[model samples]
Target: MQLQELTGYGAAIVAGLVIGLAGGGGSILTVPIFVYLFRIEPVMATTYSLFVVGTTSLVGSVSHILRREVDFRSTATFAVPSFVSVFIARWFLVPAIPDPLLELDGFVLAKQDAILYFFAFVMLFAARGMIRSSEPKADKSAPAEPPRYGLLALDGLAVGLLTGTSGAGGGFLIVPMLVLLAKLPMHRAVATSMLIIAVNSFVGFLGDLHRNDLNWRFLLEFTLFSTGGILIGIYLAQFVAPMPLKRGFGWFVLVVAGYIIVQEILTSRSML
Candidate 1:
């Protein structure tokens, strides 16, 4: 393999490792890796991201399920509308966007540029949450209150749309909602978010199936490295403190988001 391709695969492992350790941010890294390193188109990169994040998260969810940490009732409420909305977005909304998304004055925003910009902004939001990290305190002794299904479904739809458009797993969004809205404990909330992400992302990938000619060989190969990374990360999590790692990663993501915005603007200017 070429050096760049080798490096890209290495980065895949790192992305998965981050997810394994942190339980989030896989799409933030995976989409960028595909777009910049693998030289995939931005739209297609999102499609690929759904698969990578979905499959890896599925594996993680299975483990959580085995441990009985996953809350199926909340998962259903949050994930059903989420997966449905994501499918609609991938199948109809994404394809419907015009190539040049907007034009005003002398500046033109192409579809690719728009997607990257949105993704970067989402990354910024995710980074802020990470940088100002505080674990949500849940009282394990308190009697379990029922989840607010109405709010969860609404939140699910919104997150689903975002995931479909950006190919994010939406764990950053989902975990908080689960903890606060569903009244799940922190650990259970994280586990439930994994299941929700796995379902939402896979269905989103299905929505893209009809539009894209996928290179299954490369996709599976890339995912293998990511899966391996997740295993390594899970092992390391036992020894490592996650908060410090999350803070450092938040800074890294902040830089990457900045780079993407600047690079896209520079590329657009060159094209203009």
Candidate 2:
């Protein structure tokens, strides 16, 4: 195997490890790894990302499901709309976008660049949430309010759209809405977000399967390495403090997002 391919697989394991240790945000790294290291195109990279993130998240959510931490009602409410939106984004919206989305006198913005630009902004948003102090925890002892199903559905659609378009699990967006709109406790919100991410990502991948010719062997190999890393990370979590790791990871993501923008700009300029 080429060194770059080996490194890509290694990065996949590290991506899974981060998700297992910190619980979310790590899977966003998958798209960049696929695009840069594996030399996959941006659109197909998102497809590969959906499958990897979905499978790993499905594995990660199992513990939370067994512990009875996931709110089934909230999951149903948030996930139904999310599933529909994700499918639509993957099947319709993405394909409908023009190849060269924008062009000026001497410069052009390709569809792949637009997608990566959106993904980078999403990373920036995720990084901000991670670097900041945690949001105030909801009072668990307080009586639960009736969930605003309307708002929950809306947030679900938004998150699904973002996930389908960018291939990042929308946990950063999902957890907060689950807490505020679904009235789930912080732990439950995090747990429930995993389920939502798993479902949405798989749904999005289904669209890709229908539209794209996929490399199943390579995908399975990458996902297997990632799963192994997640298991190792779960074991390591017992001894490590997640908050510090999360903050550091956030800074790393910030740097990566910046790098993507700079790299894209340089590539575009070279094209000119």
**What's the lDDT for candidate 2?**
0.87
User: How big is the RMSD of model 2?
Assistant: 2.0
Backbone clash pairs for candidate 1 read none
TM-score of each: 0.94, 0.92
Worst 10 residues of 1 by lDDT: 19-28
Minimal lDDT window, size 10, model 2: 131-140
Clashes per model (N, Cα, C within 3 A): 0, 0
In candidate 2, how many clashes are counted? 0
User: Which residue runs does candidate 2 get wrong by more than 4 Å?
Assistant: 133-135, 139-146
Each model's lDDT comes to: 0.87, 0.87
Cα error of candidate 1 at position 81, Å: 1.0
**Per-residue lDDT over 1-272 for candidate 2, one digit per residue giving the tens place of the 0 to 100 score:** 99999999999998988877766777889999999899999999999999999999889889889989889899899999999999999999999999899988867889999999999999999999888836556567988678788999999999999999999988767877887898876667777877888999999999988755799999999999988887787678779877787778889999999999999999987877
Model 2, TM vs. native: 0.92
- Give candidate 1's whole-model lDDT: 0.87
